[model samples]
Target chain A: MRVAAVVKRIAKQFKRDRRSLALMMIAPLFVLTLVWLVLDGDDYEPKMGYSEMPQPVIELLDEETQHLEQYKKEEAIDLMKDGELDAFISIEGMTPTTLLEGSEPSVNSAVMRVIQESLKSLKTNTQIEEPTINYLYGSGDMNLFDRVGPVLIGFFVFFFVFILGGISFLRERTQGTLAKLLSTPIKRWELVTGYVAGFGLFTIIQSVVIVAFSIYVLDMYMVGNFVELLVVTILLAITALSLATLLSSFAKNEFQIMQFIPIVIIPQVFFAGIFNLETLDRWIQILSQFMPLTYGAEALQQMMIKGAHIYDVWFEIMILFGFALVFFILNIRVLKKHRSL
Target chain B: MSFINVKHVSHAFGKEKVLEDINLTIEEGKIFGLLGPSGAGKTTLVNMMVGILSPDQGEITIDSTKVPSFDLMNITGYMAQSDALYQELSAKENLEFMGSIYGLKKSELKERIQHVMKTVNLLPHLDKPVEQYSGGMKRRLSLAAALLHQPKLLILDEPTVGIDPVLRKEIWEEFRELQQQGITIIVTTHVMDEADKCDELGLLRDGQLMAKGSPGELKEQHHASSIEEVFLTVGGVES
Candidate 1:
């Protein structure tokens, strides 16, 4: 009954605080939409300038390039330097030598892609052997969004839940409601459980919306069961919530709660499989094992990207749950600071 | 024996002591006030009685049950100095939340919520979110919440802090009514006028009890014209 009361109060408060509700539900969608626009938008169009190119190659370039111009070699170099041309092509010894203004990697890749594709047509006519490519995990067609979308999903859940849960619990302390709560017959653990159960309700709804939007609306990779994805997402959220509540004790106010994000939340992103950790220093990479988001992001990536089942990703899942349990106990112990019981 | 007993209780914050070795007894069915200045350990003492804080030395008991015990907490209502309310929730919702935590049944909670709100004269604004409430109204609402569980003992830390004089009088009247209903109330206040309304008063200063007696007895003992002068005489002569 007490848990239900706390849940009811939290739900009511969420209803009243529409801005926080919108932030939880809409902020991630807004960011994901922006990411989708930038990472998964229409194919990149590279501008090409040709000099001393064969007629057939020029025709291929004309068809592929949105901005194709024939320029003298000197003029092409000037245009490339001016950033007007993505690349300049010149055939040397029957080998197509392309000079690229290679500052932006995305633009450089696009220019190389156009050059390679246009050259492939030439290869088909020459009867030269073409090398084959294969992917072990994801297909060659995968974009940046598809690769990092799983990690991003886990990240948003952890980030938003952490901030909201920390601030609200901290408010309970600053506003004196926590002391009022302790004056009742409710056990300290019951208060912790109530907070978890209360905030857990919203976390469940939040993860559902965030995960569904990322997969269905934003078209992120979703090879695994939706339920399993939600399990990881919710567990990740529980870990965030418990960790936030435990850390809130050291914070005197909401701003101090926010201060924890830099020390606690941001570092997890580095090791959460967003960046390649293969060549990183061994000790630094081992730090991933300690961060809850590492396990959350890893398990989420396993399910969403690799189509793994519960048993396949159960190790990371258990670790995330273990982090939540430890923080939950710590939260209960922290309440001892307010009431010995 | 007194219904509430605080014996040799002392507390400190770091190296600074907040409550000395203080002993006091409060009878049941009386409106007892802890009269003191802002930092006279009134809040700290009341918090100990409500089981929110445990004294560093000695003990407090309510009806032979030691404080800081769960069962002891079950029957004690505490209204903190600050209005500890969920500002986003309506007054009724706040009452319902507190009532539920005290293990009140649905029907009983509803009935008690109505009764407490009426007692505090907040029945009309029960649906308004506490954020919209005036400071005085919020205090009264906190009082109503403290009364919601029908606790036998109510510890109010500066309950009338922001209340207007008329409403403050009405709240004191309600406290008297609650005392008549056999509830023991411990109120903390710095206002001498409010202190005079208590059935008995414990004058505290700098973590020590200066005097404990009926308001009339205290005034007569000090040979003072008012409770303020009585406080000055006791607090002055001792220092």
Candidate 2:
């Protein structure tokens, strides 16, 4: 009966909040559509210019340029120097020479890739050297989304869960229900647990939409199991929920909760395994190790990019769960300050 | 028999005592008022009586068991000063939730919800989301929720603050009807008109019960024509 009441109330609240309903249902779709547009499209089209090139080489140059502009060799170099064009190619004595204007790695790489592809078709006796490139993820075509997908997976889970959970709990305080619940025959754990269970159920749908949208709709490179990604997202949501609710104690109103986002949720993103972490100061790197989202994003990356089985990332999963558990216990203890029972 | 006995209860937060050596016995069916100013610790004392807060000393007994017992929570309804309705939910949904938490069954829950909503005259707006409710409407819905389970004891902390005069009178009439039906009520208010409506009153000031008697008795004892003057006389000389 008690759990039913919780579930029913949760369902009612979910239904009444059309904006949150839109948030949970539409936000993921909006983001996924964005990711789809971002990842599925062509990256950085860099214009290539060739002057006084061989007829066959112009064919090669045409293949390399997104849209080419013909100019005299000197004028092309001038354009390149002035940064009007990305690069200019001029054939001098059968040796391919190039002048460059360089900025923005993606643009630079886009121009370079087409040049290389156009050159690959030629019959040159030059030996192609393949040294060694070890990749833990998709080799080169990994777009902006693939690189940031894991972080975004953790980000949306944390974002919605934090705002929803924090604001709802804050509402409970403002509405006097928190004090009223304290007056009940309820144990301190019951209120905390009920909230977790209620929001936990809601987060299930939220996680599914977020993860599924990122993976299938956005076409983020997910070489691992779908269930594993779901697990990571769900666990991250729980951690976010706990942290939000626990923080709600310190926040007297909605604005205070919003005040927490820059200070609390935003900084965690820097540490959420998005950037390559090896070069950081060892202390800062170790500090990043403490944030729950870091663990969640790491486990997600391992599963999504490395295609590791759950067993390989089980410890990270457990650690994320541990973060949730400790915060939940702290929330239960904190309620005692309001009501001893 | 006394349905509730609060004996020599001295509640304090740290060294500042809120209710000093308070003693009161409430009969099973009557309306009791804890009349005091804003800072008189009415909510604090009531919190102890309901088992939400424990007194550093003294005991509040509900029936035979101690206060704060989970068993007692089933039989007592608490309406806090602030409306406790979930703004995201409709009025009916809020009442149903409060009723279910108190362990009312489906049929009983439905019956009590209708009954209480009718009592507070909120039946017309049952389906609207509580966030859209006006201040007075919210107060009415809150009162309806406190009356949802028909508890043996209803502890209301400023239950009618934002309600209109006409609705306030009507709601008080319903409360009186409930009292006649053998439900014990303890309402707190700083409003003098509300104090006059209680069967008996405890005038509190500065963490002490300055006087305790029927409204008429309190006024006559203090040689005052109005309950407000009775309050000033008792609160001033005592302080």
Stretches off by above 4 angstroms in model 2 are A39-45, A48-62, A67-83, A88-100, A103-105, A108-140, B1-28, B54-59, B237-239
- List chain B TM-scores, each candidate: 0.97, 0.94
Tens-place lDDT digits, model 1, residues A126-236? 776767987767677778888888988889999999999999999998999999999998888888898899889988899999989998898887788999899999999
Judge candidate 1 against the unseen true structure and give its global Cα lDDT, from 0 to 1. Answer: 0.89
Residues A1-341, candidate 2: write the lDDT tens digits.
56667667877888878898788667867876776676667766678787666576568767556678777877877877777788887778888777667766777777777777666656566787757887856768787678778887888788888998999898888888988877766677777888888888888888888788777767788899988788888889999999999999999999999999998888788877767788778887888888898988888888888898779998998999999999999999888778776
When candidate 1 is compared with the true two-chain complex, its DockQ is 0.84
How does residue A281 of candidate 1 score in lDDT? 88
- Looking at model 1, residue B158 earns an lDDT score of 92
Interface RMSD values, listed in order for every candidate: 0.8, 1.4
Record all residue pairs in model 2 with backbone atoms less than 3 Å apart, i.e. clashing. Answer: none
What is the alpha-carbon lDDT of model 2 when measured against the actual structure? Answer: 0.83
Q: Provide the TM-score for each candidate, comma-separated.
A: 0.94, 0.87
* Pairs of colliding residues, candidate 1: none
